[model samples]
Each structure stands twice: as C-alpha cells, then as structure tokens.
Target: MAEVKLFGFWGSPFSSRVQMALKLKGVSYEYIEEDLPNKSPSLLKYNPIHKKIPVLLHKEKPIAESLVILEYIDETWEGYSIMPEDPYERAMVRFWVKFLDEKFLGAAWKACWGEGKEQEKAMEDAQEVLTTLENELKGKKFFGGDNIGLVDIAANFIAFWVGVIQDVVGINLIEEDTFPTLFKWSEEFLSCEVVKGCLPPKDKLSAFLLARKEAITEAAKSIVYK
Candidate 1:
C-alpha cells in the first residue's frame, strides 16, 4: 500500500470533509494536526497556492483543496464511491458542490461575520442559496439520494458549523419552519456515523467562531472606516 498522510486542523469543516471521506472509504492514513495560527513549514511547502490545511499526501504527492481531495479519494479507493458513475449525474453533483463552496459559503461566512447592512445582505444571500438547495433536495434522502456523496460532503459545513456560527452571531437563518428541508438535512447529515465521529466539539467550535467573528468584524470596519 502507498503511504498516505493528511494535514488538517481539527475545527475546520473543509478538513472535516476530507476526514469524513477517508473514514467512509475505510482508507487509513497518518494525520498531522496543523496549527492554523502558526502553520508548519511542511503545510506551506505542500500547498503553496492556498497555504491551507486539508492537504492529502498520497505516496508523498500532495493534493490541496478539500473538494478536490474528496474526488481524488473516491476515484483512488475501491469502496463506497462518493460520486455518480453517470456523466450528467456527476455533473449535477459537482454543480451543487461548487455552489456550496463558492457562493453559499462566502455568503454564509459574511452573514455570521459581517457588520451592519453588510450582515443583513449576507444573510439574505445565504438564505437565497439555501432556498435553491432546499428545492434541489426535494424527495432526496441525502444530496445525492440514498447515500451521502459529493454534494452532501461538500455541504458538511451547513450541517454542523452553521449552527455554531448562528449561536455565536446571535442569529438564526435556519429554523424548523423557515427551512424545514435544510433543517432535516442537517439533522440527518450530522447523525451519520462518519460525520458524527468527525464533528468538532460544539463548545470548542463556538469559542473559535466567536474569536473569528471578532476578527472579521474588525477587518470589515477597518476597510469601511479607514
């Protein structure tokens, strides 16, 4: 077997996504915990473009970016495929995954971390994204149907971190009535064995998000008032 290794931070959803895929596929690997505040030389050397965690090393060749790592793992491993075999189905899965990563995540990040009118607009945008996803999720057990796959893994943040962020920010975008499907999806997604095992402790995540919110708020104010 080739030597496999993963560099990641405990509290990051992106890192958790990779961890979930590995666990689901029964792929064993060495895990290196990276301190985000003080990044390691190895991490910096491996992911020069992003300089971020969740870098997977397969026989010493590094793959950066969580979503990319996910597809790579599914393709390389034999068990529990994370994507559809059909081309159009695979494309649709990629579509929502990309939407969550690019647009939804940014808006959700801003909603929890932005200030004043910025925060309001961010919440609206995030909700809009959620509405679209909820529509897509109609009659589906998971994002890809019966089993959790690419889209569900890509949306791991909405299932877990968004709740902590809401608590930290004192705002609620996902409620029982407001987004019933998403609310149900979150419950089901988080309860999955692989995901449950990987979620960061809620209290710790809450504390981390509070500090992150402070940094974002200060940065937003500095940009506007400066």
Candidate 2:
C-alpha cells in the first residue's frame, strides 16, 4: 500500500486542490475515487462528522477538509513550498483563502445556480469579490506572486470551474472585458502543467454539471406545481 492515499471525487474543485498540492510537492500517493452520494467505508471512517471527500490518509492518520489537508500536505512533505515562509504573507494567504471559501464562492454559486432576485444579488456580491481579486493580481502572476501557493490552490473554483459552470448556465461573471486581470489569471492558472494534469476533462465536467442543473430545474418545477 502507498504511504499516502487520497479519497476524492473527480469533478470536485476541492478534491483537485489536494491533488494539485500533492503534485506540486512531488509526492507519490494512491488515488481513491469516491462516489460522493455513495461514500466508501474509508471515507466515512476518516471523516465521520462532515462525511465529505478529499480526505488524506498519511501513514494511517486521516485528515479531512481540503484546506486542512492542504496544510498537512505542505507540512508533511518536503520539496516545493505550498505555503509562504514569510509570516505576514502566510497570514494574507490564509485570509484570502477564507474570503474565497466563506464569502466569494457562496455568491458565485448563487450567481450561477440561483434564480430571479437571489441570483442578481449574488452576481453583485460575486463581482465585488472578483474585482478585489483582480486588484490583488495586478502586479503578480499568481496569488503567490510567481509560484502557485495556498491561496492560488484555494481559488481553483474561480480559476476553472466557474467558467465551465457559467457556460452551462449561460451566465457571464468572469469575462475578459468585465474582469480582465482575473480572466487572464484564470487562463494562466489553467494553462499550468500541474493544473492541467489534475483537472477533469472539460467535456465530462460540463456534462456532469448540466445533468445536475437539469435535475434542479425539474425539481423546482415540481415544487412550483405542488
């Protein structure tokens, strides 16, 4: 058995974050694909509370949560540095990661999936976050300046999945004209060799998201009738 094992869902940006981190650090591990709806015994055993995927098992010790797993990967392995060595810069990375996960992503999700007034409000909130990120990227190639770091890893959804989902839903939030800097960053980030290797194929991802969207639409129609 491999010393390191990862339980992840293929279409999940969160799971891809851990994969990117492990690749960046040049760590060898076993990949365990999990069907989230029907989670495996190991995934349940490791993350009893959340019962979500992207769990990391290192030498029989399990770590849950993608962000937490990221830190663990950075600390446990030795090669490329995932987190900054500078104290203040590290703090900034953490702050941005929190903002992305807690504030920005929620708005982005609603903008893509929500209906009517709710989606409009979410678009406004998501745009504000995108503008902030565009300004932050003004003088840097990535959130980590030249290298891909914690914050960059954390923003996987914005960098890749957001565009795919927007296409599926026919909404344009992170376009070149609207947010040039962020759009450029997304292009660059997605072009990176490490990132390319880990991401699910675009066609497959789009199909998966489209199916989910259709289900939601049907469910909403049923609710309206009842």
Candidate 3:
C-alpha cells in the first residue's frame, strides 16, 4: 500500500474537491484537518507560496492547489479518471473548469459576502456567469458528458456550498426560476452518493459559514470605512 495524506479545511470547496476525487478513485489516505484561521506549520512549509489547505502529501511529497492536486491524483491513480480520454474533450473540460474558477466562483463569493452596492453588483455578475454555466450544462447530466469529470469536480461549490453561503448572507443568485439549468445541475450533483458523502453536513456547514461571513464582511467594511 502507498502512503498518502491530505491536509485540508473541511468547509472549503477546494478541499472537498480533492476529497471527492480521492474517494471516487477509492484511494485510501490519512486526513488532517487544518485550522484556517491559524494555519499549521506543516501547511505553510509544504505549500509555502499559497499557504492554503487541501495539500496532498503523496509518498511524503507535497502537492498544492486543489485543481493541480486533482490532476495529480487522477494521473497517479488508476480508477475513475477525472478527465476524458479525448484530447479535444479534455481541453473543453479544462476550459469550463477555468471558466468556473475565473469567471464565476469569485462572483458567487462576492454575491454572498459583499455589502450594499458591491453585493448588488456581485449578484448581477454572478447571475450572468451562472447563466453561461447553466447553458453549458443544458442537456448533460454532468459536464464532460454523463459521468462526473474534472469540470464537475471544479463545480463542486455550486452543488453544495453555495446554498449555505446564500443562507448565511441572505442572498440567493442560483434560484430555480432564474437559473433553472444550474439549479437542476446542483440538484443532480448533490444526488450522487460519491459527491454527497464528501459534503460538509448542512447544520455544521451553516454554522461555520455564518461565522465566516460575519468575520469577512466586517473586516471588509472596516477596511473601506477606515
């Protein structure tokens, strides 16, 4: 058996993505929960640049960044590849993943966390981005075809985290009527046992996010008013 370990924060969508990948591949590994507010010495040492969670330590070697780690895990492991075999299909999956990360995910965060005009603008921008994703997912059960792939893993935030975020901040950008396709995708994504099992429990996740929202928003406001 190979030695594998994962350092992650439970509430992070990025961490959860890695978790799901490992689980889907049926790879066994040790899990270390990081305190994000006060990061661990090992975490900082392992991923000195980002100092972020969800670092995969494989055979005592460290890999940082969830997306990078996901690819590593897929390549290293044999079962249930996160990517498609075709080159063009692979590129399209990567494109959507990049779009999800660069174009929309940040907007979702701002829509939930930003205040006043900032929040309003974020909500508007998020809706537009989500509509694009919604269209991409129009007829597919999951991105990159029927089975969950890299694009779907990248989109894990929408499947589980966004609802708690919206609830915490009292803003909803992914409503059924407005984002029907995305909304349906969320429903189906969560229904998958592999994905659902990796998710943070709702009550616990809500409590954690509510506190996080309060802290981040208050800090943002202080900076603006200062």
TM-score of 3: 0.93
TM-score for candidate 2, residues paired by index: 0.94
In candidate 2, what are the lDDT values of residues 1-226, reduced to their tens digit?
8999999999999999999999999999999999887999989999999999989999999999999999899988899998998889788988998888888877888778778887788889889889899899898888888888889899999999998998999999888998888888888999999999989999999999888896754443322100
Task: Extract clashing residue pairs from model 2.
Answer: none
Per-residue lDDT of 187 in model 3: 87
Per-residue lDDT for 1-226 in model 1, tens only?
Answer: 4599999999989999999999999999998999988999999999999999999999989999998999999999999999999999999988888888778887887777788898888889889999999999989889979899989988988988888888888889778799888899889998898989988999998887777776767765433210
TM-score of 1: 0.94
How high is the CA lDDT of each candidate model? 0.88, 0.88, 0.84
Candidate 3: residue pairs that collide: none
TM-score of each: 0.94, 0.94, 0.93
